[model samples]
Target chain A: MFPRPLPEEKPLQRGLYVGFVALILILWLLPLFAVMLTASKTADEIMAGQYWTWPKHFNLIENFQAVFAQTNMWGYFINSLIITLPSVLLVLVFSTLTGYVLARYNFKGNALVFALFVGGNFLPAQIMMIPVRDLMVSVGLYDTYLALIIFHVAFQTGFATLFMRNFIAALPDELFQAARAEGASPWQTLRHVVIPLMRPALAALAILTFTFVWNDYFWAIVLTQSDAVKPVTAGLNNLRGEWTSAWNIVAAATLFVAVPPVTMFFLMQKHFIAGLTMGAVKG
Target chain B: MSELWKRHRNWLAPLLFIAPGALLFGTIIIASSFESVWISFFDWDGVGPKTWAGLANYRELFADPQFYVSLKNNVIWLVMFMAAPPLGLALALLVNQQVAGMRFLKSLFFIPLVLATVTVGVVFGWVYDPNYGLLALIFNLFGATAPALLADEHAVTFAVVVAALWPQIAFCMVLFLAGLNNLSPDIIGAGRVDGARGWNMLWHVVLPQLRQVGFIALAVTVVGALRSFDMIAVMTSGGPFGSSEVLAYQMYEQSIFSYRFGYGAAIATVLFAIMIVFITWYLRMMVRLEKETR
Candidate 1:
């Protein structure tokens, strides 16, 4: 609107603008389009150097099947779910509680506590990598799904707390004051008032956390080893090593690993964008 | 118990609510950060007994050429990644229309941000393949040869960074889109009455209003650049002979594969030290924003 909308009578100009945007979108997604093309091609076509062409022999299904048959892709998918869901749930619970308290309470060291969450969330994972891995190993949880779960919950809670606290703080103060005047306990207020109002924020947080925990590769590699516990991201990497020449199969596997998060994004675009820009744009 | 609960629940409840998250965050994130710094001064191979090697790891790191290479690549990432915000703003402006099907187009543009970086890396690795990649196909159309980007050490980091930028750009675009939506209509109307249009409107009236979102985008980009490990790991594994390695990947390689936990921790410390400057700036800005909102 700042640039001013084109006049409705100028149909040609609007058409041209849309066409130009379409062209840019095509260019922007060229890599992904190439992968999709590759995923549908037969290995023979790929070997014959027909990457960008329509496949002479379509083998999308076969390539997808090969990804599962050759590697632990299915097991890894399940492992990712196992690790990601519990982590997301725990992060939600912990952050909601932390967010509620930090938002509604007046206390000493409140700012410092909030700062820790914000600061810790921003630090590179590499800085804490060695010690976190060591801690997991010493606790005998290394190479287990719980290792990933615990670590994700602990780490993601930082960002989630920041998000949830901001959202909770923005709620109308009058509601809390009224509840307090009625002698409703803190837990009752949270359970009845805050919880009901927090649905949208929690939904956004869940989707964000799910994508993050599912797509995690660095911690998955650092914390776990066996195929039994590895997530799809790491499993897809292993498939890359195994099927080095099978670009079609590797591309198929890549899509498989990417499907859940992409689907979530499409299904909940509004919440996802709201959650993502919460920190950056103060939405 | 009920009377006691009713009397003390105000202070007690907040403390109880905060305990779990605080404890978990404190130990795993905060405590490990300190532990990483502590481990940097010792000699250990991840699984064995630790030995004190005062200043030895730091000494070796300073003498190491690979350290410089990694440091230089990090600078490259930081500099190259700065393009995301402006590019994102461009894309946001381009799509910020109230036309038919614009929603679908915007969502399509956001697809890259949701896809795993591992997936993006793999796809881009294929795209850069000298033999049968999209680049090769495009080159063939022009009767030119495509260079194997990942295979060329000089071009490897650039290629990887380009792939990473796809998602980073989308992220910044989302931020900018949100910012653009929140622009005050009155301000825009005033600017219009003043006869500000097109580039003049954007440069004067619009750009200043976007300063806060721009700062956030810049901070996020800096962090993304520094934390670039997944793409490097999946695509090159810090090769064509370790030329594409950034500090994050170098730290991982030293600790996990090379079994030099101490050396890795030292590298981690250096990276953390670099990040502390940005982290402090970001924290101050965010805290200030929080206070302003309050």
Candidate 2:
């Protein structure tokens, strides 16, 4: 609407705009298109310089199966799930409680505590990298799934709390007042009233947190070493090293690593966008 | 017992709610950050005992040639990444149209964002492959050879930055799209009545309203550019003798691969010091905005 509708434009100008959009979209997706095509091709076809050609033989199932069967891809995939799910749940619970208290209470140090959470969210991971690793090593949790899970839950709580607090703050105060008038306890009010209303926010945060922890390569590499505990992101890097010339297998594995997050994004596209653009847009 | 519970619940409830989050953030993020800074003053290989060597790591870092290269690459990333916001604005305007199939088109554009940066890096690395890459294929059509982008010292950083820009630009576009959706119809109607159309409308009316979104986009982009590590690590590993290293990756390499924990902490501290400037500005803006909302 701001650019003026294409219908209001001259026919030629409208055509040009459509064409330009199509061009950019094609250019933007070219690499991914290549990946998809390459993933379906055989190693012979790929090595024969038929990179752009449609695969003479479709090897999709075989290539993907090989990715799982011939490598540590399965272990990596399970590790990712093991790391991501608990982290998401933990972050949601912790941040939801923190957000609820911050939004509803006028306690001492409320603003300072809120600021600390928000500020901690912005610090570079490198700043905390050495000490966090040392702490994990000292606790004998290095190269384990728990290390990544714990770190993610802790770090993600900052952003999740910010999001949850803002969301809870925006809910009508009359709801709380009505609950209080009914002689309901604060815990009861939260469980019965706020929890139900927080469904959308929770969905958004869950998907975002899952995607974040799933795709975390830095912590995966830092904390976990062996294939036994390495998530897919870092595992994919290792696979790349192992399968240097086997681009098809690597491509298949990359798509496999990407599937969960991509599915979540599409399934919850609206909430995903809402979660990401929460503070960017003014009311 | 019930009377005591009622009396304490007011304070107790909030404290209980805040405690876990505060404890986690304090120990993991805050305490670790300070510990890292403290560790920067000592010489340690991370397994053995740490020896107090005040400022020795910093002095070495100041003289290290790789540190300068990483710093310069970081500057390049910052400058290159500035293109995201403007490009994102352009894409937002384009796709913000209510044309047929626009939703599908918009979703298609968002595909890269759903993938991991590691995925993006590996895919782009193949795309830039000189022997059998998409770039090579394109060059073949034109009777020219494709340069091995990730292999070249001069082009590796640019190559990695471009891959990182893919998702970053998409992110900015999403931000601008949200901003564009929330633009007031009344203001646009008024501008239309005043003969504001085309560049006149965009430059004076549209862009002015997009100031906050633009600011957020810029800040996010700056922070992202500064924090870039995954793409470089995946694509090049700062190869060709460390030509493409940024400070984050350099810090990781120094600490983890090279067993220089103290030196890595020094690099982390410097990166933190640089980031605190942006963090302060971002927080100030956020606090002001929060105040306005209240």
Candidate 3:
């Protein structure tokens, strides 16, 4: 209301304003629109330098077939699922425990532990790349799915713990007091009080972590080299190298790679934004 | 065992709950960070035995011209990325109204943040493609030729940064939208009663409440800029001629392709040193904010 909402009675002015904003939105998403357009075009049209025109052949299905046929995109997509789902699950499990302890327990070194989680989340990934790679290699987990899962779970726990800790801390303290009075143990309190209340937070965290782990390209290259273990982001980059001039096919592949996370975002926009703004707007 | 657990569950449960997360984070994130710093002093190919090279990597890093270029490009990323928060705030304000289908429109605007940076980079690379790109199409309409942005050494960093900024701006907009929603209705009502409207109302009344969210946006943007590597890799691969390399990508190039893990660790250490300054500032702010909320 700070900008003063338009009067509900002023249909003409409101319609014009909405129309103007819609126009700007189109301009903003023009890049994505162009990609979608390119994805529908035939390879022959792309080679003919017809980027913006309507696809005469509408070869989207053929391009989709080419994406699956010419590359291991489906396998990479499966690998991404194999890596991402477990990483997200582990992050949630670990961070819930960590967040609960930091939020409820009043033990020594609590602040330091909290600081470590918060600070570690902020550090650039390159700072730890070499040692992590070496550690994965030493453990014989290199070029495997577990390497990515373990590293992602470990790294993402830092941020997830911060988020979950803040959220759990903000819950009404009287609930804990009541639980304590009822002779409920910490586990009981967690199971009865925290987990049920954490469904929304968990949902948000799950979506955010899924998007992050799925989109990770750096560690994919550093820890895994085989096409068998590589995620779709890395696979998409590999396809970029293989199909340099086939923009239509590459564009189609790009859309394929983006489908999962974008679908999740649209499906869970509320939770996604809630999770994002939990840290940004509040703590 | 059951009897003992009943008695000591309070003290023991906290430890059990914290151990897995703490251990994993300590070993992988904290320990690896320190180990990389330690590795910077040794000469190793990441596969061979380490020879104590004490400051050799750093010395070479200081002398290497590509190191300077990378450092300079990092500065460019840092400076250029500062635009996200303001532009994001503008977008948030533009779309903050409660209207029909606004929710859908808002979600549409957030599409970029959900898309992979690799996807965004590839799309933007096509956008910058000179011959058959969207830019070329636009320029052709005006009878002007488009510049091949990703191939020009001077322009490649800017081009990649622009692509990276697409998602970053969406992120900041989400933050600001949340901040706007949480603004005090009472204060806005009071401001309206006082006849404050438009920019005057925003500057004097609303802007003060947005300071914390703005600070968070700024910190996130700075961190995002420093962490810029994936886009560079997908788009330019730190080219043309390493002109677009930031410290993160340069470290990857040195360690992975060149097999100079020691030198890469040194570069990582330098980047860590720079980030420590911001990290310290960010931690302090967060700690202070927590205290204020408490």
Candidate 4:
């Protein structure tokens, strides 16, 4: 194995690896620290410089109050939750079922269908953007939450299916066959057998999808205008405009938009990394 | 009733599961793409009556200088953005060296992806802020008045692309780390025994096995750059007289801002055509690679 790490080298490499990860992680989180610090700063102090100094007053409450009072902050948050929750649910259910079907069933054009979904997964949003937009408008779904949900679920389905198929395919077929022979119908098998087994992947997908749908800016901006349907990403844009001069309030609002996904990423960091890196390693 | 349910359940259950996602996908993605194409052939403002444009929209797109500028910027995006994968791979290879608190560093590097886009935009906006920003701060340190990277015609697109590339490169690095983790030690052992080492071993042995992951990394980066709508929408808003507009941002401006639904659709159609080439080829390659591995 090109020699296992020598006894002496083991601790050294371990130390080295940990140090490297720490440095890189800090660098990655630097902008976030800047954002957080700015959010807590008074506008006057921010303009006066010494941005590195700890805030004397931590005007976070006042700034947040002003942000909510002046901007579409709450509207954006509600919009994001409304749009993201249903779409996440839809992607999870459909993708898992589709994966289950293609994995369990030896049907016609199975490979072709799987390929379409996988291919669509990687298709640039640019390709789907125009057509999807036009279709939404023609169908009278534009400027509505449904328009946003439809696009998010449809597009994300591609990636979700890719993950699910291989996972389902890789499961020991003995389980599926034994259940089938024992009079377990496909529906029953899928529900009672496969669905329970798919919990880990489903958990990963749900969290990942939530972050994606919530962070999404392009579709949200295009499909909805009024705060009635605006998600946080677009709301931040509007917030930037209204709080144009109040850097602190704007920063606070941006932090609020950031917190949910950031919290999800931190809490689910391991699963996030694992899910993202799936299919990455090769023999 | 139970027997009937069981008998029909086979097709019906999957369909029931499939229907919601499929209906949504069909209506929004597939149906919408087609609608955009149809709309592109007409001359319809979003809220107004439609006029038949035939191929006129396409012709206008062909003749429009700004369209070419946008397309050219996309080309620049596509080509230069390819740098992310190799850079990420290089970084992964470098930092994968085990050391103290390497964990913290790895997570730290990924912080850009976790930050709010508005924050990244504003922070970088300050970083590139024409006056009294980080860029300006550097210029002051050097005793020069800095030209606004975002405002300068020649520098604007490159500046935005660099910002976009920040998170993407980190993403690429993670992919490579995942690839490296799964790299077979057995193969490396053989290479070492055969007197291969270091760069030669990496290039001849390690690199070849990493092809699939590499392809994937490249494809994702390209797809991201092509659909790049954020930094442009935020930092400069495609300003400095629209020198930095790529198709995605332009499509937004056209449809949403200008309310020229038909023209916007046309731009979208063109972007879609370009994307199809890359994504189809990526899939075809991945499938072929998968088959070869099998």
iRMSD in angstroms, per model: 1.1, 1.3, 1.2, 3.2
Descending-DockQ candidate ranking: 1, 3, 2, 4
- Report, in order, each candidate's fnat: 0.82, 0.76, 0.82, 0.53
Native-structure RMSD, model 2: 1.7
lDDT of 4 by residue, A44-97 (tens): 987786465689988888888877887778877988899999999989988888
**DockQ of each candidate's interface versus the true one?**
0.82, 0.76, 0.80, 0.49
- Per-model TM-score on C-alpha atoms: 0.98, 0.97, 0.98, 0.91
Per-residue lDDT of model 1, residues A1-283, tens digit only: 7557777888899999899999999999999888888899998887887777788888999988987887789999999999999999999999999999999998988989998898899889999999999888898999999999999999999999999998998899999999999989889999999999999999999999999898899999999999999999999999899889888888898889989999999999899999988866654
- Overall lDDT per candidate, in order of appearance: 0.92, 0.90, 0.92, 0.77
For model 1, what is the error of residue A77's alpha carbon versus the real structure, in angstroms, after optimal superposition?
0.9
lDDT of 2 by residue, B238-279 (tens): 887999999999999999999999999999999988887888
DockQ of 3: 0.80
Better-scoring candidate (TM-score), 1 or 4: 1
Poorest stretch of ten by lDDT in candidate 2 chain A: A6-15
Model number with the top DockQ: 1
Using TM-score as the measure, name the better of candidate 3 and candidate 4: 3
The TM-score measured for candidate 2 stands at: 0.97
